[model samples]
Target chain A: MTTTVCGRCKSSGAVTDHQGRQDGAVVWTILRCPTCNFSWRDSEPARAIDPAARSVDFAVDADDLQRYPKILQQ
Target chain B: MNDLPNRARSISSLRDFLELLEDSGQAITWSDPVMPEPGVRNIAVAASRDANGAPAIVFDNITGYPGKRLAVGVHGSWDNIALLLGRPKGTTIRELFFEIAGRWGDQEAQISFVPEAQAPVHECRLEQDINLYDVLPVYRINEYDGGFYIGKASVASRDPLDPDNFGKQNVGIYRLQIQGPDSFTLMTIPSHDMGRQIMAAEREGVPLKIAVMLGNHPGLAVFAATPIGYEESEYSYASAMMGAPIRLTKSGNGIDILADSEIVIEAELQLGERELEGPFGEFPGSYSGVRKAPIFKVTAVSHRRDPIFENIYIGRGWTEHDTLIGLHTSAPIYAQLRQSFPEVTAVNALYQHGLTGIISVKNRMAGFAKTVALRALSTPHGVMYLKNLIMVDADVDPFDLNQVMWALSTRTRADDIIVLPNMPAVPIDPSAVIPGKGHRLIIDATSYLPPDPVGEAHLVTPPTGDEIDALSKRIREMQLGALS
Candidate 1:
């Protein structure tokens, strides 16, 4: 399995899956981080899918997910 | 003034409205190959930023996405909003606000239920091998968005406690982030109608079914984002606004949706499941921090042939979200306030979902303006979002920022500013010290009455007559002649 790192939180457990097709050829791959639940497309810009290039305003820390408030308590 | 027939009211679907916009020179179709990422978003941002008339942009050629279409900036400008309201392109914001306010509770317009075989949205159904990325022209709305979002769809849900009541059914617009092929997360606060229903279902340990309708009639979108009472139906209001019956059909989840919607995804919210949702650029011109939100599992997806995916840019003040929701927000507040206090002249809650409101009222007595402001704060939508309110005299036009500023400068006294602490607030407000609670401010900008200290002040009144109107018309004609 090819290792994938999340772009927003830099988690190493991110999974990549082929999405959509053009002429029976895969057009893009979607990368999703289970830790932070951030998803990005391989076809997106570097700023959107690269941790080092992503905006600081939107950067996520996987550890912060524990402290994030639940909008509705289950 | 050019008096044209109100053709917008007859529009049945997003494509029908797009055709109307194209005929009215309010929309443009780009046939060139455009990248899905920054290219479509960048063009949409430019169109949204155009304070001048910006046309709805339809991109027919997206690289890698064959036979797909995406529409943006459908409600991005005042001119486009005017056209959506069946008015002339140059209709003033105040006129639009009052036009919507005038039809506040007129539910005379009917809704017609159609069979699935007759519904255009059911022309194609995908129940097996559901992949949202393959189905939709999914693209990031902002550079830092967590993922592709369905930001403009009308989400229909019924109250879990009163499922059979049609009036208790709700159609709203909430941001949905795609997480997997058939899974996504929806963010909503408890204050929202959908949020309340979700909370109820979670407490009862029952799955809440929903129908997400995309590319609907323009009027349906307007009402979806509107703040109406829980018992009121968005379809009724949308039909009233359109001056025609809305076509409807039941989804697989048994939720009523617009029959002419380009696409409908039937889903069920997992009762106890929560997932990381946001950190997306919100309407407040700031990124909403990540939060745990409800997860939805899609059961079926239905669409028309070659469906057009509709999306809205919702980053800052002047995007499609503000233009799409501004009049709806203002009209409800104005109607609610007017019902209690007819002295209330107008309400301008067009900024940041009524976080800050400017109200024009006829001051009955010394503290009448304050009373109106207080009542405004208690209005259904105002209770949660009306953080700062400015009260002005009836003579001051609430829609005109220049006149409002002049009133603020001249009529406001230092002691007239009242701040109430620890009030409920919209969670997305960046300035809130606590996420969902903040202080409420009221600036009484009305002139002091007899009981209060009245300093010697003489306000200038502008000259108004038919001669000035004629001269103004002549000057406009001369300016056009000069341009020619």
Candidate 2:
């Protein structure tokens, strides 16, 4: 089986969240990274689904996800 | 509904308003197939640039999305705004501002509740095996946005502690980033009512239930973007704006929503859960950096048949965001200021969501203008976003930038500018050096009073008379005749 990696965080734990179907057939799958909660549709442009082509400005490091400020404190 | 005037009850749904736009030649339908990415966003951007006479564009043929329709720039121009208010296309911005301000006192506006069967929004329900992509024509609004966003929905949420208090319930517009088939994240600052509700929910360790209503009535959209009192009900204000009673129905979660909404997504903000969101194009014409926001899990989805997905392009200035929120923002501040100071004539806060404001007032004493400016800074919307304010004399028209500039140039003195440092500000403001804290500036551009005699001696007055008006009309007719 091929492993799906998250484009924004490059996390290997990316899992399929849902599928998009047009007629009776599935056209694309939405994959989400559990580490950073980043998601992308498989059929999207390479810039949005491929880590190497994605803009560095929006890329997130899974380990550094904790650094992002939480909007509200529990 | 019975007490409303004929014009106020004319438009009850988005489709009814769209029909009005068509009849008035204010909307167009694109029949050719176009890519959803750049096609929709680019068309919206081009239409928004006109700012005055842009028509709402409906893309009927979107590639890969058969039978799905997307409407853009529905409220992107003043002409469309005037049409929404049941006025002529040629209504001036000042006239429109006052029209809305005049209706601000309709706190007793009526709202009628309908049964689920009577609500058109409940025509279709997708409670099982739901996929947002399959239902909604979700597409990235901006190229670099982190994900597809529902930017134009009127999100309805109640104060968790006082869920039954209708007045405490809030209906406002907030950006929703679609993360999965049944999941999304919403962005709200601490100052917004939604933010306060979230804080309350978090403190109580409970999920915050919300019903996101899309493609709502134009009046609802206007009041949703408005900055009103925390306890004020947007539905009632929307009724006031429409001059008729607004029809509403309860969602699966018991949240009230527009009966004519094209789509309704019932969701809950999970407790103690945060997710990576944003880096989306924001209203400040810049991309909002990534932050951890609250995650929402969809519980049920309902919509009318063949739902028309409504979205907005919110990058930079002069977009629908400005036109949608501008006048509504100005009217409330004007109404609030007029309560304390009847000498205040007009207010213009159309620039970048009231970050800069202009006020015209009749100065009573030496420092009265400055006092009015300070009082404005305390208005509901002013406290957070009114960073720079310009004070003008009662003779000047705040809506007319030419007059405002003339006042700034001729009446302003170097010593009249006051700066208050480290004040609360809109976090998305790109000029904010420290995210949510910035300096406030007030320029007393009104002419000096008794103590100051400089430049108060000789001032040229503008000529005005009935003869001038008659000549102006004759000359305009002559010019048209010559062109023809």
Indicate which candidate wins on lDDT.
Answer: 1
Q: Candidate 2 residues B28-79, lDDT tens each?
A: 9988877666677878898899888898888878765778988888898999
In terms of lDDT, model 2 sits at: 0.85
After superposition on all C-alphas, the RMSD of every candidate to the true structure, in Å, is: 2.0, 3.1
Task: Look at candidate 2 and tell me the lDDT of residue B130.
Answer: 74
Query: Candidate 1 recovers what fraction of true contacts?
Result: 0.69
Alpha-carbon lDDT, every model: 0.86, 0.85
Per-candidate DockQ vs. reference: 0.66, 0.44
Residue-wise C-alpha lDDT for candidate 1, range A1-74, written one tens digit per residue: 24688888888877764465678787777777878888877888888888888777677777766887888874
Among all candidates shown, the one with the greatest TM-score: 1
Taking the tens digit of each residue's C-alpha lDDT, what string does model 1 give over B305-366? 99999998889768888889988898888988888999998999989888889999999888
Tell me the deviation in Å of residue B239 in model 1: 1.0
Number of clashing residue pairs in every model? Answer: 0, 1
The segments of candidate 2 whose C-alpha lies over 4 angstroms from its true place after superposition are A1-7, A12-31, A41-54, B1-8, B455-457, B464-484
